[model samples]
Target chain A: MKLDEFHLERIQSQWENIVDYNLSESGVEPLRLNELVPHNRLQREILETKLGYPQTNGSIPLRRNVSSLYEGATEDHVLVTNGGSEANMVSIWNMLHESDDRDEVVVELPNYMQIWGYSRAFGANVKSFWLTEGDGAWLPDIEGLKDMVSKKTNLIALCNPNNPTGATMKEEHLKAIAEIAEDCGAWILSDEIYRGAELVEQRTPTMWDYYDRVLVTSGLSKAYGLPGLRIGWIACKDEDKVRDLWSYSDYTSIAPSMLGDRLGQMALEPAMREFIEKRTKRILKENWAAMEKWLGENEDIMTCIPPEAAPVCLVKYSESIKSTELAESLIQEKSVLVAPGDHFLLPQTIRIGYGHDKKKLVKGLSLTADFLRGEE
Target chain B: MKLDEFHLERIQSQWENIVDYNLSESGVEPLRLNELVPHNRLQREILETKLGYPQTNGSIPLRRNVSSLYEGATEDHVLVTNGGSEANMVSIWNMLHESDDRDEVVVELPNYMQIWGYSRAFGANVKSFWLTEGDGAWLPDIEGLKDMVSKKTNLIALCNPNNPTGATMKEEHLKAIAEIAEDCGAWILSDEIYRGAELVEQRTPTMWDYYDRVLVTSGLSKAYGLPGLRIGWIACKDEDKVRDLWSYSDYTSIAPSMLGDRLGQMALEPAMREFIEKRTKRILKENWAAMEKWLGENEDIMTCIPPEAAPVCLVKYSESIKSTELAESLIQEKSVLVAPGDHFLLPQTIRIGYGHDKKKLVKGLSLTADFLRGEE
Candidate 1:
């Protein structure tokens, strides 16, 4: 199948290393082995074992731990993937078949490009369901979402707390979304990669908790700071879906990396997870405040509603400048990188990633301000 | 996007753990960290760092080293994949765009199910080119293969030092195959995953060395005995194809595991690879003899040919018994496991793997003999 160019990855590959003050990333600084290993972890023992191809499904213990996170699920309901990327890819590729072209996929816009991008590229009748600013917060238009799902709808795709926008969906909103899928007999594929990065005490409700047919995708890359491990999973209560993904997984990546699998199992240990969550919460609190203060000072130039969850929030700039142009100017002229909202299908915003090094985040924002002044 | 069940994986998943003596795998004994580390390798240092995402295209050094293995090719032509599995998947998925229904894929029979399964699953019109047993040996019908490829052919899929059968194509045969693809303007995807596992002094000829449009896929899984690392790559002199794979990489697994990347780079170090090759050679020589002797003892019941390259060979047995039933009974009664050739679309044959623990290999073969005796 011929595919369109992946816009976000193409842009990041260009700017990630070349630019100094980069902000395009969507996760916190990665965890050091020392931080994750408090002397009793899999650091030594796992490294010593025969690292043959990991269990094709996943390590049972790892799947067990992952299943424990979601209610009414077991290891039988989980299939570990290469990353959250594969988890999303398999869910779309396995569930949505372009039979007769009547199958529709309702995808939220101004979000991670992969979900909608894949649904559109592989011949799904994709309907872009927009998430608009509502009462000083970012939320999907429930009525619009409801309208998008019909008898022909095959899947409803979502990322929460959403990519780029850092928007958390309310339980009532998710229930409404689930009811639509239920009524239409469509599947719900919720990519909850940023689920654990919540700023509020109450966590973002997992989509599976609300929907019976939900396939929840998540990984250690976001809040766990283990993107290097490339460990992610697809969770559902349905045995058929799990087995279906297993077949697709065989054709795709086969299974997660064995070394990564060992690391993943260790990372999900209750103690390690608690420690990581606390550490992530601290980092997010510190960096998010710096970003807020930086935006407050440049109120005339930029507008950003504080993210209720996630490590990042979308920052809107003047409509006169294209986000790509601003982003290019930031990286090329000032060595500061920010994600152009154009790729996210929003033209005048930049995704500010404050989950990285605080000093780089401050400098990146400062350079963006300087670039804006020059644009005028 | 709905896929047929991956039958081999399904069968393996059921029997792999239940079996005590497993001869189903395709690689030599897996490496322990102690064997891989001689005080100079990456075992300790890589464990200390923050394992994040590796370079998306592959780590530069790793690509550079992989390129050095192929004459006239540079790092620009390499795209590291999750495993040989992903390498084959992406090459097929990226290059074969089912633009018109007439695009055909020519795949070798009595081979890894994935090679042809993926081609057929992705909507390509697949022609099964047979590899026949002639002169008491496995030989590809070159004339038949030539007939299969025409102007309409999109891909000629092959696994060199072939899976199950362990048949290595002669250099003349490879060039002739390449000429067919070159004549038809079709791409040749050569999965040379067993390239370095040759039992003879002359190594298997690489597909890219002969064909300009060939994608040669190999990994540390076989010769290097590091399947646990999950490091595999696609080597093509065609720069556009390399870049095309990079884009497909984004949609699939994104990148190899960072820890795997570091380990991959180390595994490719000239000294380390030489050491591994020597060690692998020693193991293969010793183990292959044991297998040959076992087959010699069971000569009346089973027929076999010596493998010129890989550590496994497909053994054809008496037609009265099905390989799957024989395999099931062997593993169930004696806890010995071997691959059923029915998954390869051939019955009355079992893929016998000799690259395992010597004692287990001896024990497994004895049990197989007992099972065969009881069958008679």
Candidate 2:
């Protein structure tokens, strides 16, 4: 479909390059090469290999690693994409069987725009299942989801831990979502890009385990902090579906770059996989603790939904100020970047990435706080 | 919009891994890192860099070099894609304005499938302007092209130093094509991925030099023999169109890998850019000479369109065997891989890549000649 502007990207592009505190980003502050690979080994190997088109799916080792993220999965079930964005695109692209009558695409609201945008672009009727923020927890509205699914539901899309609000769906909630889809013989697509970044030791239930017709997409962009790698995959999928998606891949990116394939494989290599995850977990813990402490002192001006997972969370401003105005002023006057709530159409909050450098997050919050206090 | 299979890829997947002689490939034998970069210097820098996401458009230097290939284009006129494949996707993507009556996409026959495949998938009617092989020249039938264009044409796509045929469209012919598009107010998309691979020192005029609405796509893949990098760009004369295509980039591949971007910039860097092109030209010349000699000795079995540019050429087998069957036997019995004409929908021909190692080209041609002669 011919689409005209991509608003979220246009807004993110403004700060992707210019800001010191890029809290507008969905992933953590990117890791250095040395962080993912030993300086003397994979780093040198990454530069030495023949750079040609990688396999249409992905490297065997990388896919095998991804398979370990789920049960009963194999390399044949995966198609590595450019990022979770492409993973998201191809999943809907292959699953979409559109007719005028039964065309409902159900997704959570205040979500990653790609889901609804792509579902709508792919010629589906979209309906939202939303989340509510209460007592520092952002929980999915179960009754709303139940109402959204039916015989008309062609697809049910979920992102957990969710973007913007940073909500994680537990096993019980995931089972309920799956049962609803099962009742109508509908497909479920779970975007678990933020799965590994949960603050506590609590694990999120993956769609791979939840539904037979489920498609799960995650990548190095988020928890692995290698957004630059542009490596992601779709899994718990049928073999024919993977092959079918690879065809659309021909008309899309063809394949991810070999260099990225190598780096992603390195990131997923058994020896260093947990090591890489630990680095992000460490950063998340430090930044989250610092932001929470800072938020406690500044409770008069703002409060957060306190993200349990993912790198970022939403902060609600007590001042009667538009989020867009505060966000613009923060970037313009203070050179700080925080996505305004209105960026996601939430008028009173801004999303802050607490997985950034502790100093940068604190300084960014301090400047934002000063701006809000002055407004008061 | 729902596509079932990618036949050529499915066939190649069977042989891309197992074959020793892969003439089915579209590009020259891919370059090793040492061939593209000085083993001592830029190699270290590529590995040492933070590998952060690259600039949304492309690196300044890479875009600058791409701009140089055109007459009056600049960095702002380009959008770097995953490869020529995505280069093709986005070009068709941003140009079409769909209506049943005026939605024709005109392309030359014996062309790469994506130009037509993606066009049809995106809801546009595809029309072909025929090409003829006569007196050792693969000429775009100019009169036929004239008949193909009308006011209803939305886009005309061409691959100069064409795929399969390796036909190079000259400046005069390119201008004539532009005049046709101009008469109809339609856009031109030139896939010049094989620009520097001319066998006889002849050059293909870029579409950027010919038409106002033309979008020209090329990359490190075909001509430079760096297909692994998956780096390609589209150049149009308009800046807003480039910006508009970049918006679609968010939903497509998002961006090329940071390593690919870095290596691309390194490939196009003033110090080493010419060295990389020189390496591919050297291989092309050497391999082309060997294939021409082999074909001379075996004219009884086959004839070729005699490609002027690009690394691969189509060989018309005199035998009555179906192209797919011959290609299948060559791969299965002889461990050789040549693209069947049926892959592009022509039965009595197979495309052989002459940009491989000189020994492999001679060997691959010899084995195919022996096989065809034996068939007779």
Write down the lDDT of every candidate, Cα atoms only: 0.83, 0.80
State which candidate has the highest lDDT. Answer: 1
DockQ of each: 0.65, 0.59
Tens-place lDDT per residue, model 2, A112-230, is 77878766766778899888876667878888989878898888898889888878888888888888889987888889999888788886668788788888889989888888888
Best by TM-score: 1
Q: Clashing pairs in model 1?
A: A51-B228, A228-B52
**lDDT at B247 for candidate 1?**
86
Per-prediction TM-score? 0.97, 0.96
Tens digits of per-residue lDDT, candidate 1, B265-325, equal 8788899889888888888899998998988988898898788888898888874788888
Q: Where does model 2 sit among the CAPRI classes?
A: medium
Local lDDT at B98 for model 2: 26
Candidate 1's DockQ is 0.65
Off by over 4 Å in 1: A40-42, A98-102, B40-43, B98-102
